[model samples]
Target: MQRRDIAEMLLLAALWGASFLFMRVGATDFGPAALVFLRVAGASLLLLPLLAWRGEVGALRAQWRPIALVGVVNTALPFALYMVALLVLSAGLASIFNATAPLWGALIAWAWLGDRPTPLRGLGLALGFAGVLWLGIDNASLRAGSAGVSPALGIAACIAATACYGWTANYTKQRLTGVPPMAVAAGSQAFAALATLPAALWWWPATLPGPTAWAGAAALALACTGLAYLLYFRLIARVGPAKTIAVTFLIPAFAVLWGAMFLGERLTPTMLGGCAVILLGTALATGLLRTRRSRPAGSPAP
Candidate 1:
C-alpha cells in the first residue's frame, strides 16, 4: 500500500476507535436509541449529499430492500447494542469483543455460504472463540458497574452485536453484490435513521445534554461513522479489502489508548492478553495470516 493509504487506514482505525469513547461519553446523556439515531442521522446528512453528487441515488433506490436490511442489521442494531455495552463495559473491553466479528463472520460464511474454511482457518475459528470465552469467563461477572448494569449483560450485548455484524457481512456478500459502496453506505445510514427514529423519540433524554456530550455525539456521527466509512471504502479501493480490514486489528489498541487517556479507564493485563489472543485468532480466521506449503521443484504455479 502507498503511504497515503497507510495514513488513511490508521486514521480510519483511530476514528473508529474513538467511537467507543464517544459512545461512552454520549450514551449516558442521549440514551442508546437517541444516540444511535443521531449517529446514523448525522452520518446520512454527511453521506447523502456525496451520493447524490456521484449520481448513485438510483443504485440506492433500486437496492433499497437489502440496503435497508443492512441499515437495521448492521448500523442500527449493532450500534445500539454497542452503546448498551458501553454503559457497563470499558471502551477497551467492548472493542475487544468487537474484534471477534470476523471470527463469527468466518463461521457464518462456512455455514451459510458453503464456503468451507481451510484447516488453518478452522483452527483460527476455534482459537478466536476460545479467546472470546476466556475473556467472558474472566470479565463477564454478575457484578454491576456504576451504571447499575451487570458486566455479564454488557458482554452478552457485545457478543450479540458482533453476531449482527457477522451476519451482515455474509448477507452483503450474498445479496448486495453489485451495489455501489457509496449508495450502500449512504442509504443504509438513512434507513437506519428512519428505523430508529421512533425509538429515539420515545427514549429521548428528559433534559438536554451538555455541550461536551453533544460534541462527542456529533463527532461520533460525522467523523467516526460518516468520514470513517468514506476512508474505509477508499482504502478498499486502493489496497483491497484484505488490507483495509487490517484496520480492525489496530482499532482495539487505539480504543485502549483513548479510553486510558481520556476516560482514565484502567487497562488490565487480562484485557491486553485477551485482545492479543483475539487478534491472532482473527488474523488466521480472516486469512490475514496463512500457512504456506512447499511445492515440488517442477510444480506449476497453480
Candidate 2:
C-alpha cells in the first residue's frame, strides 16, 4: 500500500474505534434507540447527497428491498446493540468483542452458505470462541453499570450485535450483489433511519443532553458512520478488500487507546490476553494466515 493508502486506513480505524467513545458519551443522554437513530439518520443525510451526485440514486431505488434489509440488520439493530453494550462495558472490551465479527461471519457462512472452513480455520473458530468465553467469564459480574444494566446483559448484546453483522455479510453477497457500494451504504442508512425512528421517538431522553453529548452524537454520525464509510470504500477500491480489511485488526488498538486517553478506561491482564487470542483467531478464520499454503473458502469482505 502507498503511504496515502496506509494513512487512510489508519484514519478509518481511528474513526471507527472512536465510535465506542462517542456511544458511551452520548448513550447516557440520548439513550440507545435515540442515539442510534441519530447516527443512521445523520449518516444517511451525508451519504445520500453523494449518491445523488454520483447518479447512483437509481440503483438504490431499484434495489430498495434488499438494501433496506441490509439497513435493518447491518445498521439499525447492530448499532443499537452496541449502544446498549457500551452502556455497561468499557469501550476497550467492547471493541475487542467487536473484533469477533469475522469469526461469527465465518461460522454463519459455513452453516448457511456452505462456505465451510478449512481445518486451520476450524481451529481459529475454536480459539476465537474460547477468547469470547474467557472475556465473558471474567467480566460476568452481576453488578450493574451506571445505567443499572448488568455486564452479562451487555455481553449478550454485543454477541447478538456481532452475529447480526456476520449474518449480513452473506446476506449482502447473495441478495445485494452488483449494487454500487455507495448506493448500498447510502440506501441502507436511509432505511435504517426510517426503521429506528419510532423507537427513537418513544425512548427519547426526558432530560435534554448537554453540548458534549450532542457533539458526541454528531461526531458518531458524521465522522464515524458517514466519513468512515467513504474512507473504507476508497481503500477497498484502491488497495482491494484484503488489505482494507486490516483496518479491523487495527480498530481494537485504537479503541483501547482512545478509551484509556479520554474515558480513563484501564485494561486488565485478562483483557489483553483475550484480545490477542481473538485477533489471532480472526486472522486464521479470515484466511489472513495460511496454514497449509492453500486458500481456504473465501470470507466475505467487511
Candidate 3:
C-alpha cells in the first residue's frame, strides 16, 4: 500500500476507535436506546442533505427493505448493545471485545454462505476467542473482588454485539453488494433512527443532558457516524471488504489512547495484551500477514 493509503487507514482506525469513547461518554446521561437513536438520527439528518445534493435520495426510497434490515442488524442492535455494555465495561475492554467481529463473521459465512475458512483462519478464530475468554475471566475476577456489577457481563454484551456485526457484514456482502456504500450507510442510519424512536421516547431521561453529554452525542453522531461512514466507504471502495474491514484491528489501540487522553482512564497491561491478541487474530483472519513466497519481493503476487 502507498503511504497515503496507509495514513488514511490509520485515520479511519482513529475515528472508529474514538467511537467507543464517545458512546461511553454519551451513555452517561442517555439510555442505550436514546444514545443509539441520537447517533443514527443525527447522522441521518446530516447525510440526507448531502444525499439529496448527490441525487441519491431516490436510492434510499428504492431499496427500502434491504436498507431497513441492514439498519436493524448493523446499526440499531449492535449500537444499543455496545452502549449497554459500556455501562459496565471499560471503553478499552469493550472496544477490544468488539474487535472479534471478523472472527464471528468468518464462522457465520461458513455456516450461512458455505464459505470454507482455511486452517490458519480457523486457528486465528480460536485464538481470538481465547483472548475474549481470558478477558472475560479477568473481568469476573476483578468484579468479584469489588462491590460493583460484574464486568464479565459487560464483556459478554460487547461480544454479542460483535457477533451481530459479524452477521451483518456477511449479510451485506451477500445481499447488498451492488448498492452504493453511501446509500447503504445513510439509509441504514435513517431506518435505525426510526426504529429506535419509540424506545428512545420510552426511556428518555427525566431531564436533558448537560452540556458535556450533549457534546458527546453530537460528536458521536457527526464525527463517528457521519464522517466515519464516509471514510469507511472510501476505504471499502479503494480496497475490498476484507482489507477495508481490517480497520477494526486498530480501533482498540485508538480507543485506549482516546480513553486515556480524554477520559483519564488508566491503560492497564491486560488491556494492552488483549488489544494485541485481538489485532493479531484480526490480521490473520483478514490474511494481511500472509505473503506469497512464490513471488519475488517488490512484485505483485497473485
Candidate 4:
C-alpha cells in the first residue's frame, strides 16, 4: 500500500477506536437506544446527501428489504448492545470483544454458508472464545452487579453484538453481491435510523443531556460512524480486503489509549492479557497469519 493509504488506514482505526470513548461518555446521558439512534441517524444524514449527489438514492428503494435487515443487524442492534456493554465495562475491554468479530464471523459462515473451517481455523476459534471466557472469569463485577448489571452480562451483550456483526458479514456476502459499498453504507444507515427511531423515542431521556454529552454523541455519529465508513471503503478499494482489514488489529490499542488519556480508564492486566490472546486468535482466524500453501507432490514449481 502507498504511504497515504497506510496513513488513511491508521486514521480509520483511530476514529473507530475513539467511538468507544465517545459512547462511554455519551451513552450514560443519551441512553443506549437514543445514543444509537442518533449515531445511525446522523450517519444517514451525512451519507444520504452524498448518495443523492451521486444519484444513488434509487438503490435504497430497490433493495430496501435487505438493506433494512442489514441496518438492524449491522448498525442499530449491535451498536446499542455495545453501548449497553460500555455502561458496565471499560471501553478497552469492550473493544477487545469487538475485535473477536472475525472469529464469530468464521463460525457463522461455517454454519450458514457451508464454509468449512480448517483445523487451524478451528483452533483459532477455540482460543478466541477462551480469551473471552478468561476475561469474564477475571472480572468480578460480573457477579457483583456493580454497574446495575453483572459484568458477565455485559460480556454477553458484547458477544451478542459481535455475533450480529458476524451474521452481517455473511449476509452481505451472500445476498448483496454486485452492490456498491457506498450505496450499501448510505442505505443501511438510513434504514437503521428508521429501525431504531421508535426504541430511541421510547427510552429517550427525561432531561436534556449537557453539551459535552451532546458533542460526544455527535462525534460518535459523524466522525466515528459516518466518515469512518467512507475512509474504510476507500482503503478497501485502494488496498484490497486482506490489507484493509488489518486496521481491526490497531483499533483496540487505540481504544485503550484513548480511554486512558481521555476518560481516565485504567488498564488491568487481565484485560491486556485477554486483548493479546484475542488478537492472536483473530489474526489466525482471519488468515492474517496463515501458513504457506503446500503444493501437491505432482505439481510443478512456479
Candidate 5:
C-alpha cells in the first residue's frame, strides 16, 4: 500500500471506531429504530450526491434488488440492533462486539456457499465465539427480565448485528459483484432509509433528545457512515480487501481510547482479555495470518 493509502486506512478505522461512541451517546435519547433511521437517512443524503457526481447513480436502478437486500440486512437491521446494544453496553465493549463481524461472516460463507473453512479459520471462529460469550456473561448478568433492556439483551443484540453483517457481506459478494463500491454504499444507505422510515416514525421520541445526542447522531451519519465509506471503497481499490479490511483489527483500540477519554468508560479485565482473543480470532478469520487452504479454493488468501 502507498503512504497515502495507509493513512486513509487508519482514518477509516478511526471514523468507524468512533461510531460506537456516537451510538452510545445517541441511542439512549433517539431510541434504536429512530437513531438507525437517521443514520442511514443522513448518510444516504451525503453519499447519493457523491454517487451522482461519479455518474454511478444509474447503477442503482440496475442493481436495485440486491442493493435493497444489502441495505436491509447490512445497514438497517444491524444498525438498529447495534444501537440497541449501545443503549446498555459501553462504547468500547460494543466496539469489541463489532470486531466479530468477520468471524460470523466466515462461518456464514462456510455454511451458505459451501466454502470450507480450514482448521485454522475454524479455530479462529471458535476463539471468537468463546470470547464473545465470556465477555457477554461477564459484563452483564443474564436474567429473565429487568426494568429496562437487560445488559444481556444488549449483548445478544450486538452479536446478532455482527451476524447480520457477516451474512450480508457474503450476500453482497454473491449478488452484487463488480458493482461500483460507491453505488453500493449510496444505494444501500438510500434503501435502508426507505426501509426503516416507518419504524423510525413509530419509535420516534416524544421529547427531543439533547444537543449532544443530536450531534452524536449527525457525526455518526455524516462522518462514520458517509465519509467512512468513501475512504473504505478507495482503500479497497488501492490495497485490496485483505489489506483494507485489516482495519477491523485496529478499530477496537481506537474505540477503547475514545471511550476512555471522552465517555469516561473504563476497560475492565474481562473486556481487555475478550477483546484480545476476539481480535486475534478476527485476524485469522480475515486472513491476516497464514492459514491452510484446499486446492479447490483456487488459491490461498493473501
Candidate 6:
C-alpha cells in the first residue's frame, strides 16, 4: 500500500475510534435510542444534499427494502447496542471488544458464503476470543463489584454489536455491491432515523441537555457518521472490503487515547495487551499476514 493510502486508513481509524468517546459523552444526557436517532438524523440531513446532487435519491426510493434493512442492522441496532455497552464499559474496552468485528465476519462468511476457514484463520479466531476473555477477566471496573454491570455482560454486548457489524459488512458486499456508497450511507441513515424516531420520542428527556451534550451529539452525527461513512466508502473503493475493514484494528488505540485525553481515563497494561492481540487477530482474519504463493524450485507448487 502507498503511504497516502496508509495515512487515510489511519485517519479513518482515528475517526471511528473517537466514536466510542463521543457515544460515552452523549449517552450521559440521552438514552440509547434517542442518541442513535439524533446521530442517524443528523447524518441523514448532512448527506441528503449529496445524494440529491448525485441524482441517487431515486435509487434509494426504488430499493427501500434492502436499504432499510441495512440501515436498521448496520446503523440503528448496532449503534444503540454500543451506546448501551458504553453506559457500562469504558471507552477503551468497548472499542477493543468492537474490534472483534472481523473475527465474526470471517465466521459469518464461512457459514453464509461457504468460504472455508483456513487453519490459521481458525487459530486467529481462537486467539481473538482469548483476548476478549482476558479483557473481561482482568477488567475489574466492568464488574458489579466495581459499581458497574457484570463484566461478562458488558463484554457480551460489545461482541454482539460487532457481530451485527460483521453480518452487515458481508451483507453489503454481496447484496449492495453495485450501489454508490454515498447512497447507501445516506439512505441507511435516513431509514435508521425514521425507525428510531418513535423510540426517541418516547424516551425523550424531561428537559433539553446543555449545549455541550447537544453539540457532541451533532458532531457524532456529522463527523462520526456522515463524514466517516464517506471516508469508509472511499477506502472501500480504493481497497476491497477486507482491507478497508481492517480499520477496526486501529480503533482501540485511538479510543484509548481519546478517552485519556478527554475523559481522564487511565490506560492499563491489560488494555494495551488486549488491544494488541485483537489487532493481531484482525490482521490474520483479514489475510494481512498471509503469504502469497510463489513458484518453488522452478516448479509450480499448486
Q: Score residue 4 of candidate 4 by CA lDDT.
A: 98
Residue lDDT tens for model 1, 94-115: 9999999999899999999899
TM-score of 5: 0.93
* Predicted structure 3, TM vs. truth: 0.92
lDDT tens digits, residue span 105-133, model 2: 99999999999898999999999999999
User: TM-score, each model?
Assistant: 0.96, 0.96, 0.92, 0.94, 0.93, 0.91
Model 5: per-residue Cα lDDT over 1-302, one tens digit each: 78998889889999999999888878878888899999999999999989999998889989999999999999999998888778778889998999999999999999999998878778888888889988987977665333277788888998999999999999998988999999899999999999999999999999998887888899999999999999999888888897888899889998999999998999999899999999888877666876445333667556
When 5 and 6 are scored with lDDT, the better candidate is 5
Q: Quick one: RMSD of model 1? A: 2.3
Deviation from truth (RMSD, Å), model 6: 3.2
lDDT of 4 by residue, 1-302 (tens): 88999899999999999999998888888889899999999999999998889887777778878988999899989998998888878899899999999998999999988998887778788888899889878873646444477787788889999999999999999888777788899999988999999999999999989998888888999999999999998888888887888898999999999999998999999998998889888877777776556334665432
Per-candidate Cα lDDT values, in order, are: 0.92, 0.92, 0.82, 0.88, 0.89, 0.83
User: Model 5 segments beyond 4 Å from truth?
Assistant: 143-147, 291-302
Clashes per candidate, residues 3 or more apart or on different chains: 0, 0, 0, 2, 0, 0
Clashes in model 1: which pairs?
A: none
- Candidate 3, position 197, lDDT: 97
Residue 265 of candidate 2: its Cα lDDT? 99
Question: Over 4 Å off in model 1, which ranges?
Answer: 294-302
RMSD of 3: 2.7
Regions more than 4 Å wrong, model 4: 143-147, 293-302
If both were scored by TM-score, which would come out higher, candidate 3 or candidate 5? 5
In model 3, the runs with Cα more than 4 Å from the true position are: 141-149, 291-302
CA displacement after TM-score superposition, residue 94 of candidate 2 (Å) = 0.4
Tell how far residue 189 is off in model 1, in angstroms: 0.4
lDDT of 6 by residue, 266-291 (tens): 88899889878877777776676663
Whole-model lDDT for model 3 versus the true structure?
0.82
